[model samples]
Target: MVVLPMKEGDFIKIEYDAFVKETDQLMDTTHEEVAKEHDLYNERATYGPMSVVVGSGTLIKGLEEALKDAEVGKEIEVEIPPKDAFGDRDPKLIEVFPMNRILSLPEFRKGDQYPAEGMEIRINNRTGVISRIFAGRVRVDFNNRWAGRTLVYKFKVTELIEDRDDRMRALISSVYPHSEEFSFEFGDEDAVDIILPDIVKLDTNWAMAKFKLISDLRKYMDLRTIRLIEVYMKREEEEEHDHGSEHSHEHDDKAPAEKGSEGEKKGEEPSENKEASTDGEEKADEKKE
Candidate 1:
């Protein structure tokens, strides 16, 4: 069995732990047990091997480059400088504002106390953490929390996803983890159809996920068309009622009119055929590229 090295556009599952080189502080990991051991576990996060397309620009520069030519099931450790990880911190990113200005914000105006040091805040579309609170002044640092720190990563490519359907499923599950039961089918003329689960329709993140899924499909797959099918079937009771009505209407003179109306009703099928090509996502693809 020959294990080929990963290359651009390869879909693979990876597990990694990232740490700050200076303090050896664990910044992130794919393993749940490691996160628990470090007391960095998040109740909302799903921890496990993550799916990624190599050279898709989803990973930090150093990490993505390291995975390129790496074989599956081989653990590799690499040290990444600030330049390739998060970039060096810039002093210009630190700004000091009048303490009164911070206190006057809408959040604090409602009786909230002065923000304590290390508290993160978002203002004017920029997010920063409170670094200092001096006499009548508040200093905020907008640089990334890990800026200027060299990072160390221990990672391994666990599995290579080769099947087209499995690759699509993996990509979808990576973005929307709850979509394990979703169905994918190849259609005529280089098109793929994805039948979304009913639960996804109720998700508030569905809109964003739909667009992201479309973008990723276009980027990674060679499909000319991507369709998201949302099926809203009639309830069993409703179907039974309609069936009874149709049976009675068959014996009536108005049956022809009723059948015509039913034909019109069934025309709603077009509404369920949501094609990515028709949506404005092609423009988004251009912008993303």
Candidate 2:
């Protein structure tokens, strides 16, 4: 059986090693050893074949275009020009900020030291690196690190995913890359259900993250319902009771009634004796009359 060349809308997993063409600096790789050597080892990251939707912007334009005719199990080394890779570096992205302005950021405190050169900082919702600091001013560069540099990638297609389960897994991995575990259920009516791990459910950004994940998944698969399930065990919380003082007050109120009942019982014999004496006097007076 002959496998067709990769085309748009196909999902493929590939093992790739990328480098800067000019400097030969390793930019990215799937191999664990290479990542360790480059001090980029992330224990949480999945250091293996990565999934990509062919026409999706999951990859740079050049790399995605190269995969159009790529074959499985065959290594291909492609050189991408700066224009097609990260784009030419623009001087406009390098802006200067006053020392006072930099100090006024939310991350900075009144007595905190100002950011130094080579430090990354967020300003106006954009992240930039401090390239220079002098004369009460700082230069922040917002350009991509690889901008104005060509990129070289050696990659091979490891697997072509067609199974619905694998495709769903790929979609999840793309969105929640560091997710621990998740399961999927497809119904007869084209509805989908995803059971996320407990850890993911605890994320603070879960509301926004879930929305983006569902949006990305819908781009590839049509579904009537997508249920994202997160189950959590509720901690047994003890209800705070303020009835201690109230109960004591109730006991105090009942004490008078209890004492009155005891007094009535104690006085019953004297009252009966007095009534008997009165009845005898009345009978003696009637006989005398």
What's model 2's lDDT at 110? 63
Global fold similarity of model 1 (TM-score): 0.72
* Cα lDDT, model 2, residue 81: 96
Candidate lDDT values, in order: 0.86, 0.84
Q: Which is the leading candidate under lDDT?
A: 1
Predicted candidate 1 versus true structure: per-residue lDDT over 173-227, tens digit per residue: 7578775779988987479988889888788888897888888888888778988
Clashing pairs for model 2 are: none
- Cα RMSD of all models vs. native, in order, equals 23.8, 7.4
Clashing pairs in 1: none
Worst 10 residues of 2 by lDDT: 234-243
Q: For model 1, state the Cα shift of residue 82 in Å.
A: 0.8
